[model samples]
Target: MIGLVLAAGAGRRLRPYTDTLPKALVPVNGDLSVLDLTLKNFSEIGLTEVAVVVGYRKEAVYARKDELEATYGLKLTLIDNDKAEEWNNAYSLWCARDVLKRGVILANGDTVHPVSVEKTLLAARGDDRRIILALDTVKQLADEEMKVITADGQGVRQITKLMDPAGATGEYIGVTLIEPEAAEELADALKATFERDPDLYYEDGYQELVNRGFQIDVAPIGDVSWVEIDNHDDLAKGREIACLY
Candidate 1:
């Protein structure tokens, strides 16, 4: 299976850095970027072929494409998302629909996490042809997180940004294993989500699957370090955890 990374959004809160580069290109360490770490993590899992959905500052990614590929020893496929600056990530992910058929272990370009997170999901994915999300069950709940509601505290009942933090079992940590069997249906759900509203998070696509009686389960990362880079504050935290990775 090929790996995927959605590096499209214009993280406006991160100004000067994002002015010339997409959030994925932002440096967490001295020279290594969030994309660098993401590709590194994928490489550790032996994923030599990967696709990246790029927008916002698409030129920036194109500029670094060769370098990133060389660094991770990966064969990179770039998918363009034209609505990146105007719409949300549901569309960004949908832009990659045609390319993802072998299944994929996807991660958001803006998140900083170790290879262990990928390892966790990969291990749990064993022979199960379902979407498996890497969830942060150990982290405390917050309103800003993309919370997940589970029926058995294991099977995802709902996944949304609007869910009440008190009722959420855990946070969907922006990384997932989408098995091949569910790819077509997921593509359909993502299209429906973006068509209904141009601003829905990609989590809504997973919700659509669950609504259609598909199981979206969670795998706990188990006390691992991870941070989603949204603003400067998150960038700082990302830098801290990046070093540990």
Candidate 2:
């Protein structure tokens, strides 16, 4: 399986930091960037071949490509997104559909999590061919979190930010394991999601899969510490967590 990262968004709330660099390049630990931690996590877990979907000041990432590859000991596949500034991540992910059909572990560029989160998703990849999402079941989520609700069989019934926190089982940590068996369908779903609305999140693609009678399961990461860096406050919290990793 290949490791994929969605690092296309402009992250406008981040301002001057994102003015030249994408959100993924925002340094969290000294000189180590959010991309650094993500690549490190993927490399440590043996997904050494990675594809990064880049846009919104993507030149910053390209400038550091060789250094990043040498540091992580992974082959880099960079996917360009021309509409990154206009569209949401649903399109960014769909842009990578042609890159990895065998399988992929996709994570958001702005999220900072430990190797444990990747291990949690990898551990659950048994004979099951369904898509598996790493969910933080223990986190007290706010409205901004992409929440999921499970069915009786632990299948994800609903996944969206629109749901009430009280109705959610957990927050999807923006890490997903897509098996070869489901990659094509996922791509189609992602395409449809973006075609319907350019601003839709990739979780909407998961919702499309669920709506199609496909079972998208959730692997709950118990008591795992992670943060999604959106603004200055989130960046501060991410720095603290990055130090622990």
Candidate 3:
């Protein structure tokens, strides 16, 4: 499976840094960017081919494409998301539909996590599992987190940020493994989600899949040190935890 990264969003909360570069290029650990860590993890997992969805200052990624490839020792396919500034990540992810056909270990570019999270997801891959999300069961859930609710024997029942935090089983850690078998349906779901409302997140697309009777499973990352950088505060937290990775 190839590695896919959704790096199209313009993190407006993070100025200056995101003014020229996308959120993915924001450095969490010294000169090593969030995208750098993601590529490194993908390379470590022996995924030599990777695809990245770029928009909102795409030129910055273009400038670093060759260098990133050389550093990771892997070739990259940059997918364009023209609507990134206007729409949410549901569209950004749908833009990579063709790449999804090959199956992918997907990561949000703004998340800073250790390679173990990816290793955990890879280890949990089963024949019956089509979509497996890295869920942080150990973390305290908040309204800001993309929370999940599961059924007894079934997989995920609901995944959304609108749900009450008290009722959620865990928070989705912005990492997922989408099997080739589920890609087409997921792409369609994403399309429907974004077309219905451009502000919808890709997590909403996952909700659409679950609504359509898809068994979306979850794997716990077990007390991992990770952070999703959204603003300056999150970036500070990311930098603190990234060093441990």
Candidate 4:
């Protein structure tokens, strides 16, 4: 399966660090960047062909891309989202439409999770649907995280930006294996949402899919060590979790 890494965001939450470099390139642990850790995790999972969508500090991302390809012998496809300043991550996915057609595994570039993602991908068996790895976060999720609300213990009822701490079912772990056709449908919905309001977040498209009775399976990753690097504090937290592996 093709691996699609969304690294196009400006990472405004990261502040001064992001002011100098893309958030994906921020140093983690001793030397590895978040993007490097993500690619290494993918490599461990046997995903070799990778498409990294980059926009903010695109040159830095490209330079790191070169370094990764040289070091890992990884075949890296770099796609630029020129409109990243105006659009959200759904637009980044739209930029990689060609690869998305073959049922690619999608991930955010800043997440530092264990290398067992290969098992998660192998577990995927449904035909032409979106499979989201939903982690049961009984611990309070941060406000910026994307959350999923479920119904009947199976269906994804809604995907929303975490605003209310009370009603959330779990935090979405930023990994999804989506069938090409379902991705296309999501792309169309994303376009429509952007047409209506270009500033609307990608979660709106997911909510639309859930409202239309689309079956997005929630593959539970309960208590699996995962941390998303969004700030300096998050970087420290991710490094701590990375030690578990």
Task: Report per-prediction Cα RMSD to one decimal.
Answer: 1.2, 0.9, 0.7, 2.1
Runs in model 2 with CA error above 4 Å? none
Regarding TM-score, does 1 or 2 come out ahead? 2
Off by over 4 Å in 3: none
Q: Positional deviation of 143 in candidate 4, in angstroms?
A: 3.6
Candidate 1: global Cα-lDDT?
0.90
Using TM-score, give the best candidate's number: 3
Candidate 2 residue lDDT tens string, 16-114: 898888999999999998899999999999877999999999999999999999999999989999999999999999999876586999999999999
90-177 per-residue lDDT for model 1 (tens digits): 9999898876578899999999999999999888976464789999988898889999888764489989878789888899999999
- What count of clashes does model 4 give? 0
Compared with the true structure, the alpha-carbon lDDT of candidate 4 equals 0.75
Cα deviation of 57 in candidate 1 (Å)?
A: 0.9
Task: Output candidate 3 Cα RMSD.
Answer: 0.7
**Rank order by lDDT, top first?**
3, 2, 1, 4
Backbone clash pairs in model 1 (N, Cα, C under 3 Å; residues 3+ apart or in different chains), count: 0
Give the winner by lDDT.
3
TM-score, every prediction: 0.97, 0.98, 0.99, 0.90
Q: CA shift at 227, candidate 2, in angstroms?
A: 0.5
lDDT of 4 at 133: 56
TM-score of 4: 0.90
State how far residue 9 of model 1 sits from its true place (Å): 0.8
